[model samples]
Target chain A: DVKVTQSSRYLVKRTGEKVFLECVQDMDHENMFWYRQDPGLGLRLIYFSYDVKMKEKGDIPEGYSVSREKKERFSLILESASTNQTSMYLCASSTPGETQYFGPGTRLLVL
Target chain B: AQRVTQPEKLLSVFKGAPVELKCNYSYSGSPELFWYVQYSRQRLQLLLRHISRESIKGFTADLNKGETSFHLKKPFAQEEDSAMYYCALSGLGGATNKLIFGTGTLLAVQP
Candidate 1:
């Protein structure tokens, strides 16, 4: 079975603070993605990296950025945390257009 | 624009009842659809895909291009089947192969 792990399961940050959410997949998938899951909005893609150092903005990339320095790890960075940024963050990894495996999400709370 | 829509926000059913979760998509080209499930305290995982035409955990979804629907169904609902279900669409025109997800439906199977 594939294992996708997130650095944190729960996080709390003050408004205006910079926050980082990390994800690592052991399956060596080529594509990694970051998304925020909100009630009634579902999962909106923030950023996705197809390969190391390559990234693309998704539907809701505003206020969020991502980094992929290695094959197994993808990181999401929030330049400034806002109350509206409080949502469940999910990380997923896939091989090209194949099935995606997801990490146990991180629930972020900005106060 | 590529999009996935899950009409129901919550569906409550009794054990041994039939289950159906509706999902529709809007995409120009051929769409690859999938059903994802997230159980309590568990990572999101793939339940089934339209192309494979296989059922997992007694759930099956058939892609109807005419209606642009891929609704998940099961003959009998088990308590363990309760979870959040998300419909995702891939197979876009570009090589990036990103997925668009629906808002998700929460299934509650009461004993």
Candidate 2:
């Protein structure tokens, strides 16, 4: 089975503090994605990486960034955590033309 | 720009009732669509893909190009079927495989 693991299930951060959310996929998929899931807005893409050292901006990439130094690992970074950034963060990995496998998700609260 | 839209925020149905979750899309090219389900306390996972043409857990989705919609349907809803459903579209080319997702619908199957 494809397994995607997130670094944390819940996190609390102070305003202006930097936050890092990590995701690792054991399936060795080529594409990794970061998405923020809000109640009414659903899941909005933050950033995505098709390969190591390469990244692309998604619909809502303003306050977030992503890094993929290794094929199996992808990290989402918040330059400065804000109250508005508090939401559920989901990570996904998939092969080309295949279904994405998602992590359990991390709920972050910025105070 | 490519976009996916799920009109309903929530849908409630009693057990054994038929259920349908609507999904529409706006894309210029031929699109690949998918339905993903997230059960309570479980990771988001692929419920079905249009290309696969398979039913999962009594749920099936049919992609209608004329209407630009992919609606998930089930003949008999179960209490276990209560979950959040998302519709997604793949990027233009198969190489990137980036997905554009809808706002999502929360289905409540009451027993």
Candidate 3:
């Protein structure tokens, strides 16, 4: 079975701190994504990487950045965490234009 | 721009009653639609896709190009079927096929 794993299931961080959320996919998929899910806002794409060292900004990319050093690993970085950034972060991996396999999700709370 | 919408935030039904979860999409190009379900404390997983044309666990969905909708329906609601359902869309063209998700509907199956 394909597995997309996130580094943390739950995290708490202070405002103004830099935070890192890691995601690793064992399926050898070529695409990885980061999204923040809010109560009524749905899931907003923050960043996506199609290949190693390649990244693209999604609709809501402010205050967030991403790095894909390896095809199996993708990382989401919060340059400066803020209280408003508290939300559930999900990582997903997929082959180009195919069904995505999602991680368990990381619930991050920025205080 | 591609977007998915699930207007109902919550849907409740008796165990033996039929259930329907509405989903709509806005996209100019041909898009692949999908229904994903997340059981309590479980990771979000694919339930059905328009392309498959196969029903899973008694749930079925048909793509309505005229209405731009892909509503999920089940003949009978089961207590185990209670879950968070998300509607997602992916563009078919050369554009990167990142799945855009809906706000989600929480289904409550009353036993």
Candidate 4:
């Protein structure tokens, strides 16, 4: 079975703090994605990486960055956490032209 | 431009009733469609995809190119079926296989 795991289920960060959300997938997939899910807005892509050290900005990459140093892990970074950045963050992995498997998600709260 | 739209924000229904979650897309070329579900306190997962042409957990979605729609349908609804449903689109002529997702619909199955 495919398994995607996130570092945290819930997190609290103060404004202006730097936060990192990590995702790891057991399957050896080539594609990894980071998305922020908000109520009524669904899942908005922030970044995606098809291979190690390669990244592409998604629809909403204004407040976030991503890293894929290893094939099995992807990380989303918030340089400066803001109240508006608080949302459920999701990670997914997939092969080329195939379906994506998602992580458990990180519910972040910025105060 | 590639985009996915889910008109309904929430759909509340009693158990045993039929369910249909609408999804539409705007893309110049052929697109791949999928339905993803996230149950309460659980990780998001793929429910079904248009290319698969298979039913999952009693849910199925048919892609209609004429209307640019891929709506999810179930003959009978159950309380366990209540969750957040997201419609996603891909195959935007990119090798990365990045997906564009809809805002999502909350299915509330009340007994």
lDDT of 3 by residue, B1-111 (tens): 678989999999999999999999999888999899988899889998899899999999999999999999999999999999999998874446788899999999999
- Model 3 Cα lDDT, one tens digit per residue, A25-108: 999998899998888777889999989999999989999989899899999999999999999999999888778889999999
Instruction: Rank candidates by DockQ, best first.
Output: 4, 2, 1, 3
> Scoring model 3 with DockQ, what do you get?
0.68
lDDT at B15 for candidate 2? 97
DockQ score of each predicted structure, in the order shown: 0.71, 0.75, 0.68, 0.75
Which stretches of candidate 4 lie above 4 Å from their native place? Answer: B92-94
Chain A vs native chain A, TM-score per candidate: 0.98, 0.99, 0.98, 0.99
- In model 1, what lDDT does residue A85 have? 98
lDDT by residue (tens digit), candidate 4, B2-107: 8899999999999999999999999988898989999998888989988889999999899899999999999999999999999999984467888899999999
User: Lowest summed-lDDT stretch of 10 residues in model 4 chain A?
Assistant: A95-104
Model 1 bad stretches (over 4 Å): B92-95
What are the TM-scores, per candidate, against the unseen true structure?
A: 0.97, 0.97, 0.97, 0.96
- Residue A78 of model 4: what lDDT? 98
lDDT of 4 by residue, A1-111 (tens): 999999999999999999999999989999999999998898999999999999999999998988889999999999999999989999999988888899988999999
Rank list by TM-score: 3, 2, 1, 4
